[model samples]
Target: MTLLRDLPLSALRALAAAARTGSLTRAADELGVTPGAVGHQLRQLEDRLGVKLVSREGNGIALTRIAEAALPDIDRGFDALASGLRRLRFERRADTFTIAADPSFSSLWLAPRLDRVRAALGRLDVRIVLSIALDSMLEEGIDLAISYRKSSARDLASADLFTERVIPACAPALIGSRSDRDGAGMLDRLPLLHIDQTMGDDVYPTWGNWFTAAGGQRKNIDHGSRFPLTVLAAQAAISGMGALLASELVLREHFRSGQLIEIAREVPALTIRRRLVWPVDGPKARHAAAVAAALAATAIAEADGPWPTKS
Candidate 1:
């Protein structure tokens, strides 16, 4: 009896490839090995089986009657093996908790704090999908989602992460001194950085709205280069491209590093609440819950104090 344990998987793979392609060179290419290696594997398989599985017919090789009889079963066995491996790989991927959030939130807020969250979650893989569209977490295979708006879905569980305070900020070089303007006048003289409203939901506060809150004329706020994302606007501000109205939490690192400075005059900062949401009952509910907890803890820590001052 040919013991299954004695059958080498590599030899079988080589035989299957050669049988499927009908050429040693083609099989070698597919297997990413030399033709000689493929031939050696075939020889070893045939030697063990004690049968002539393939014979060289003229310039090419042909499978013998014995090989023809067994090829179908060999192919079926490899197919089953491949299917099993694919399933295992997919299951392993599913173990990773996938989160979806706004592009700016993912890049600026979540990414910087990922190390701490990862340390807390130990052995769990976290995947972040940055997008503006609010997709169904269950249907999209997402473990959790962070959104500016609260989820209205009946099947989802939600938690408040943090409320963002939006403020006017600019590169240190952009401001001459505290006397640059009495208050909101500085914005009119300098280029006002605006976040492009079309990229995300209309709920995003605008430079015009901020100006109005600061008791500045709306006409002075409307003119400036527009950025599609908050991160982009923050980058422009850091580069001294213009003065940007941005979230204090999102640009905390920049403020701490002195790359960007908040304007002295305080406007009524826009307050937007961020929420963590997940399907109430799903395959990854436990994993999502763990991730959500880590995120909430991190959010609280961040809200408690500013980022560490870096020289």
Candidate 2:
């Protein structure tokens, strides 16, 4: 309630730590200070507030009723201050990278390659935000965005990572029940689960598009069920809700495992390329390049076949 500038922040922090841990020594250890230093701060804080903050016993300390009541508010204030400082420090760190990506790309592609990234770049801190909002990356805070794009945008310094390719997918049970061997022909009988883009910023790659690309017709294009994300649509397919036009990058392992059947591998290619994009002249550009290289290499290796097979 008082003016923040008038409060002794360091002493309040020490009081909060001591109240939380119930011991000056433990709190001191956490703060990287000596027990005596912690005690001095606590004493200073109590003197400033004109209250006995802690009751000292044999080896431990207990907060007084007044201390207990005031500590929650004090701790909350300290926590908010600490969080702000952390964000400031993170923003200042030149090596720390933040990436904005689609949910499917984050889960299917980048997440699998994180180990390779860690091994290549020692202890690099990456903050991955699930988004297709390119505007967020152009803002001050976001460093880069790895996204599925049909072409490069003028605002972004972009490099191609990999193409977004789709294959017909359904649960193993659904595939087994079908009489046809070719996946494309089965679309007429089965419902096609659609993944509608929630933001309307990204276009949904559909079975009809793939079918037409592969020299088939969209006469049997089914739009029985819809989901917001490809991952959710794939899950619905896996549960036998309907067939899904899913990315090969995402469905590779599932297809090999027999969890989901690839209705047709030779279907038309509705491929979209992934791009590592950032503001043309920003500090994040180099970091985005490094990440793009690492991610591209991973995607290439995975796309080589010998994918995860049914055990």
Candidate 3:
């Protein structure tokens, strides 16, 4: 190991390839070099190590027991080096355009409008991540984030995109019918689909909260099955399982497509301000800011809702 510090790696690489393939010709073919060049490198390596580790047998070469034993580790070292280079290359590409986003918003909201975003940004390599909250934006080498958490760090800049505006929406079929022409009141034994954000950074409203907000009283707030994400709950509601107090921000498509109808106009739910966050004066800051503006404009264009306007 100590002798290898100053030695040129090309010779060692030739030895490994020759030993692996059992022939200098095959090694040279793998390395895109002549058999003579491979033999010469092997000679140089043996001279540097001060040992006859390779025995020439025509086009084939045989290694000593110790050198043969070392081949596996040497191969592993080369593999690790190659992996490191690949990681560096990926980091370079990822740093150009990477975005972290809340799972619900990313899956339900932003995913559908990605075409619009791509069209607006134009000539982009975008990566929108739906993952957990990190200790820092730079930890994952993220250029930006569309998150429920606002940035207050000195190194980061954020713009308030929208406030959480949850509303009760359910399948069109679930509402009142038969003799009750209008969907005015709650159905008999209406199954409430609860959102379980127990591990999340923010707490969302329960069925109890919405009922209270609507100036009514309801029991068994914890009756229904709970889902971790609003998008999942919305899907359940869309499937006619029950009503979901969903956010209008992400469920705009469902509401528009008539898969889900508003059981109520709006309800006071667990409110959290979502922000477009990025490193202040970063290499991608300009791009991030441009992305934020494009997204906001897109959201505004979709419908008149909760996006804040310039004063």
Candidate 4:
């Protein structure tokens, strides 16, 4: 055995192959070696063990009883070895998916629900990048994207997942103190907050826009404290920092908990459809479909209303 150890592993491999295949010629073809070479290794092995491992058959060969008895164990060991290598490769590539979305939605809407996604897809590692840039759909590495817009452009296939309605929300205490007063004029007295730092052509609804849409006198819309993200603006509203024009999609829980109050249903609250956007001809569309379905279920569950079918 020590002398055999001094020889190449290819010799043992030939024996295993011949045992399983039951033919020296077939083993040689599979191993990319000549039949004579395989026969030579078998003869060397049989001589070393003082046993007949294989016998000749009409222009071919067959494994002996000893070879037949050893084959099952040898095949099981090789299968396990192959499976282990495959598992290692799968684990190494596990953390490869990346998704991007609006910063506010990422923080307020998706961040809170990621644990469920993680538990559902335990094997795939995920990375979320907060981006207000509209170019994420064109970015090379992003596998999925979420954004708020009225209509999807022709360049991208956007599925409307939910509608984000802008409403005047403030701390319940703030609303309670002013309950007796005319709620429409409350914005003139209370400080307001804004999130307008994103560099894009997309126009978000503002207080003045809502006022004009309602056929009311336009007030100073730009006189409020500005924040860069919707979640932060909502937090400011929750802490009584000021009344914020924020999305109903992100503030539904706060409204339910009485932490925040929706003031004056007359704001004609702008409803912009939130969408899952992806390249029209890319591989990400299938990935986008899964996200779209999850978001659709979330929307229907949270809204307590029939969701409009997506086009």
Candidate 4 lDDT, 1-311, residue by residue in tens: 78646754566689888766778888999899999999898888778778887887886678889878876876787788779987785555445445677676777778787664554344556677765355654544555567664335575666667767777777866754455223577766778888774633156677777777667754576787888777778888888888887777677777777777777664466887766765555544555456656766776676786322211
Q: Better model by lDDT, 1 or 2?
A: 1
The parts of candidate 1 lying over 4 Å away from their true place are 1-93, 118-123, 197-201, 307-311
lDDT of each: 0.77, 0.72, 0.72, 0.69
> Model 3, 17-112: lDDT tens per residue?
888899988999999999999889888877877878788677577898878888898889889888998789666764457778767878777777
Instruction: List candidate 3 segments past 4 Å from native.
Output: 1-96, 115-124, 177-189, 198-203, 215-217, 265-272, 304-311
> Judged by TM-score, which candidate is best?
1
Pairs in steric clash, model 1: none
Which stretches of model 4 miss by more than 4 angstroms?
1-95, 115-123, 150-155, 175-182, 197-201, 282-284, 305-311
Could you say which candidate leads in lDDT? 1
Query: How does each model score on TM-score?
Result: 0.63, 0.62, 0.59, 0.58
- Candidate 3 clashing pairs, residues 3+ apart or interchain: none
Candidate 2 has what TM-score? Answer: 0.62
Which 10-residue window of candidate 2 scores lowest in summed lDDT?
197-206
Candidate achieving higher lDDT, 1 or 3: 1
Q: How many pairs in model 1 have backbone atoms within 3 A of each other, for residues 3 or more apart or on separate chains, i.e. clashes? A: 0
Please identify model 2 stretches exceeding 4 Å from their true place.
1-95, 119-124, 150-155, 176-179, 198-201, 214-222, 264-266, 305-311
